[model samples]
Target: MRRDSVLQIQHSFTGPDQGTKGTLYLVPTPIGNLEDMTFRAVNTLKTVDVILAEDTRNTQKLLNHFDITTGQMSYHQHNSQSRIPQIIEMLEAGQNIAQVSDAGMPAISDPGFELVQAAIAANLTVVPLPGANAALTGLIASGLSTDQFAFIGFLPRKKSEKKAFLDNLVNFPYTMMFYESPFRLGQTLEDCQSAFGPDRQVVVVRELTKKFEEITRGSLADLVAHFDENKTIKGEICFYIAGNDDPSTDESLLQAALDDMPIKEQVQWWETHESMSTKDAIKQVAKQTGINKREVYAKYHEI
Candidate 1:
């Protein structure tokens, strides 16, 4: 659709409160389909004095679609720091403003947390609007255990840092979720295999809510093989790694390994000899030493 057609819609929204101008509205934009925009969110954007957008051009399309011409300013990762003070000042001045990311909810591994934090510190009212989210959608459709899960967002791009992050999370008892771009999906699955073990169960959800949506479930080893053989992968990918189901490891043996070498070294020894999850091995060490498993994972992962 032409950009002007969307803007035409933005120019038509009305009934925004001109009084009580200091409230901060957190509006969630659609992750994929533009039709997902909620009615209340649309009205809020239309009524607010200003809209803080991660990408003004993208938001402009939404505003134009809804005929919402409320003033808008760019508030993204690069500019948010400098812009935050101004926004706070405006809010304190009683000028209501709305903040939005390009997709999904803002401040969710996105760049709006500081603004929300500042607003709370300054005693301003903050409102959250429910909307589309890739993580939750992927989790639900992934067919992986989701009663409890951790959203790790995007993993580090650096090989060492990413591996360490994965290694440290092996002991997490809850299911885990991570975002991965198609470009790096293969490497990410390989790293998960190394950190969580090849036999660990995982589900990959891609292109959610789009025409090509797909959900793949299998062991990490199977995924690694699929990605390795495929020439290319497309769309955003969410990785859900199932927690280890084996009973906790033996503490005395884990401690013996830890006492003589480093934690990662110990985990490697136990994993190689006892065939245990790195998390289980760490738990065993923590059980013997009366230390936290988290600390053990950190020490071993060295992150």
Candidate 2:
């Protein structure tokens, strides 16, 4: 075992350590439990020349817990933009740096994007180390369709803007995700219900990975009622809403065909002119003329 390990090390170190001229490593930290920290992540954090953290105090606790003595400086939403040039300078000087968020991935609905943008434009190599993400954890448990989904990050805080945001989703057919604070969860649900209708399905994930982790499943109305009785809610909230079920299609040519024709002739014309499936043409005809689709198909002898 010793000889083999030595051989492996010799092979790896055969050439000069052309250590990255200045690599920006985006490192993901555990959202809740510390045990979720990967071996590589801990090692990288310890060995990196510098670690840019969203919160120095919060990251200090994590570093102390793991016996990692590397230096950490506050680099968050408020200061990331201003700090970008300085960080890029350090990378240009051949220093290896790692960036971490308070929880989960950095530059993901969080600070660190500007620094990344600066690093890229400066031609510095950027490395990504993936780990925990709250959105995915909640999404999988939401019981909503996962084939197609959109992550809208945090919702607008202003009531009017937030309402407009939800209202726009009424016609969207893919599952949607959003992050919300516990205090705003109920209000967000209410807005969603108002826009998407009370019957639309929604799932709420709260305090994921923590002791109070909870996943509530129900329609918009049901969820609103559930939270109303609970009074106080806590922890981060990840919300998922099922997509719109109904869609409206164009009817221009069909409207023209129906203009001067009798119901029977209109239905027949639509079947031929619209070139739609016979079943679909009958349904459209029934909706437009207040006639039963089956009766229309029967009368047209097209059933």
Candidate 3:
């Protein structure tokens, strides 16, 4: 390395916020409770020339409470492409900006990573401030092994894709965290029950750090039963589950396969693998699951 170039790389003392190039501060807002907002985060947002919010209305209420009169511009997934160049131009013009999500950290199941990468590519300073995160909040209290864990924000909505995604994580040997909507909570739980088995434990953290926050722990079977009766649950759910340590038994493997597949496919499995006739497969399914053959027949007809 050249001696003069080596000197330029050393002894950089100025904070990221102070630079000839305008900085993009990735500030984290409170996930639920307003008190969770950090002092530094609020100060950074106040000092920046403009705030780029996932939703202007939601961020406006938060800024009002803090009495931060900083201006905010809408920057979400739909408009990210056009806005990135505009933001970059502002940064190049030495206009400091702070990017924030509706809740929690920016870019975690939210839109901000693209802008951050753009800033980096343009040699602009990017600063990140830590505050609240739903995944970590649920993990610390999940009572599961958190020494090494994976954060899978949200699964694919399609049944086929969701099953494939969960199948890939079935044998992950650490705790797993996921964020899911309350509307699809039951079906998502059923998918998890399929992948992790009925005996695996799960912890559900709802509306973390909020007034009506709730935390429930139980086996996969227990949760499936609880959610089945309460189909109209509300609030965001932080799902934590224990990963597999050993290979699944034959019975559980068969159940997992059945769990992911439609009834028609299961009937075909019975016909092909168990050497049963079509009528025999239907009869066996009804007898084994206690679900009437009429309903099973209806599903295939619909398909």
Candidate 4:
């Protein structure tokens, strides 16, 4: 077994030693605009022995734009497992390496986590440089609460699964941010409306930092209608939803309590407490319990 060094404390300003293992730099690339790239990031890339790019083809454009001549090795999701050991060996051999995703920060819903973990376990120093992040960029301008927020990356693809996944977070009190594709924007909005209710505030930011950047803010229902009418949503998206502030009326808790009741009783509970119509109440019950809507409807109507 290879014996690793004890946990070595890192100080950002501590200069590298010729005898020590090389540092792993987690550099953030611009999400859209190239100007967002930091001076330090550029210098680091220039100085590093090599770069581990998520997509060599995509990163080549950025490197070309910046006139960076560093060689790159592909390190993405498909190849991370195989690449990690090799990367650690490179670091061990005192070859400084910088890891960059195609855009934004490394390891935040990107390919850097496994590599970072491996580097740390091997007791090598890991350094991070701050740069563009779609979620943070959207949140500051979103007009939503930023004091506390959760970064929920891409969600489940299927409609029922998506709804069920969101249903679990309905009562989360901190602001929530998510990344989504343009193709599924409409259905995602619909699912948000069902899970979080129509009145909840939301902000949708598209094509951020680009010429066609747009930030739309309104209630869930309002944005749902707006996007539905437009029908041609495009660009990278980062969306924010207001969190549940009313713990007294925490719906998830209420639903959990209702779990003890019969299906008919659950439907009735939503109607009486939420002032929902019979059909709407039945749908709500079905969504919460993962029961088939038809089964819930039949149970509600049974004598």
Candidate 5:
């Protein structure tokens, strides 16, 4: 059954022709500075039969600046369900459409995802044209580790819900980026301090590629204090927080160990010396000695 299922699988190629189906171009608009708009994005927008915009008025300003004369249709969170079927129909009718958000990439925090999913399900050619993105722009300049990162766009509005959400990522080992409003910056900083601790490094990037762009870096506590004192922070923001570098480190688990101790002996030593339970000793020994917990458990059990 597995072999038969694998044999029946089909692959969709991005560049290949899909008969009469029209292409859905995921065009990215500049987050801030108009100069950051890519040439390809402009050309695609200009040539497409129609443009699906998050806000036609906001996107109009961008279109006007680029002298793009393409017509726009509103596709936002509220109307996405009603609009997706129509969009898929247009694509099926071979009318090339371009989707754009107010800023940055469409679908990053927007309802453009539904339309994209509809297009793909209809076997339409979906092409993405990269341009300015606030998260990546701020991340590169954030002074945080870029090797591995997660884009956690906007937390829940409710304080309790937001705190619980952040609590889950306390030991997350990748740099995290978040989009935030200037109004909530202070409160959010306070929350970060509580979840990740006061000493966790954070960078607050405001108004990227704009005339009044600002990048502030400090510990979560310092940022909380700074925002409290300043009382006014304007423009769009990208919040970058450093992840737990040594997530395994626990002060209570620290103890002297014999250099040549076996994995099982190490677990036993932690149990005897630190007065920990069998389960806890295995966990602590795994952390202290950089061994996998399951491997330590198996060794200790003589499995």
Candidate 6:
């Protein structure tokens, strides 16, 4: 057994030898605007021996734009399984590599996590350079509280899983950020309204730093209405929903909790406490929670 492996080498955190191995520099590229690329980033990309890009074609365009000719090797979800070991081997031989996503920071909702993990496990040097980030970009312009926030990169695709995911954050007290597709914007806004309530303040930023850059801030209800009416939205998206600490947010949660109550309990409370007629109680709940009056009545009658 050749157990004298390179993985056994202790990481030298203090010196010139720290990153001498096959170093993986996590380089951040421009999300939308080309000017966002930093001078250091440009130089690094030019100097690196190889670039592991999420999309070689897109990276090639960027390279062509800046005239940086470092070779690009496709390293995306489908190709990672085969490419990782090859990249790792190259790194082990002291080849400096840079990993980049199509835009923004790699691995934050993009590819590169697996490569980073493998490099770390093998005791290789992994360096990250900060540049454009959609979440932080959206947050700064969101006019929302930036003091405390959570980055919920992307939500689950499945309905049940997505609902459970949003439900889990129903009471989060910090500003919450998310990356979602323009295609699902309407449905996502509706789901968020269902989970966080109509009154919760939310900011939806799309096509960030690009020509169609849009930043709309309002209650979840209003945004839903806007999207439903327009039926047209495009480009990258970063959604910011206000935390549970806000008074309005708290009220929305309380209303949502009441909506979650058993129909029988709700009917009894409305009928007995407020002396409201059955139809009136159903109408009130439907009005307050935005559920269909017929659905509320059916559920109430069933109970």
**Each prediction's TM-score versus the true structure:** 0.76, 0.78, 0.77, 0.80, 0.79, 0.78
Among all windows of ten consecutive residues in candidate 4, which has the lowest summed lDDT? 10-19
TM-score of 3: 0.77
lDDT of 4 at 83: 92
Please provide, for model 3 over 1-303, each residue's C-alpha lDDT reduced to its tens digit, 9 standing for 90 to 100. 656522122112374545666888899999889999999998998999999999999999999999999999999999999999999999999899999999998978866989987887776777788899989998999999988999988999999999999998887888999999999888999999998789999998898888889998999999999989878788879999897778677776686778788788888888999999888888877776678989877765564
Cα RMSD, model 2: 9.4
Tens-digit lDDT track of model 5 for 1-303 = 455422222233434555466888999998889998999999999999999999899999999999999999999999999999998898889899999999998889999888877776666778888888899999999999999999999999999999999998998999999999999999999998999999999999999999999999999989999899998889999999998887844453244334367888888877888799999988987887788999989999999
Q: With candidate 1 superimposed using the best TM-score fit, by how many Å does residue 120's alpha carbon deviate from the native?
A: 0.7
Candidate 3 stretches greater than 4 Å from native: 1-18, 248-303
Pull out the clashing pairs in model 6: none
lDDT of 2 at 262: 65
Sort order, lDDT high to low:
4, 5, 6, 3, 2, 1
For lDDT, the strongest prediction is 4
Model 4 lDDT, residue 105, Cα:
91
Candidate 2 achieves a global lDDT of 0.84
lDDT of 4 by residue, 1-303 (tens): 999767567664564643478989999999899999999999999999999999999999999999999999999999999999999999999899999998999999976998888887877888999899989999999999999999998999877889889998887999999999998888899999999999999999999999999999999999999999998988999999999897435567777799999999999988998899999999999999999999999999993
lDDT of 2 by residue, 1-303 (tens): 455422112122132333647678898998898988999899999898999999899999999999999998789889877888889889888898999999998889876888887876766677888798999888988899999999988989999998888877787999999898888888889989998889999999988889899999999999999999995998888989998767333464346557677666876676787797767877888888778877887877844
Error of 1 at 173 (Å): 1.1
* Model 4 / residue 167 / CA error / Å: 1.0
Alpha-carbon lDDT of model 6? 0.87
* Model 1 residue 130 distance off true place after TM-score fit, in angstroms: 1.1
User: What does candidate 1 score on TM?
Assistant: 0.76
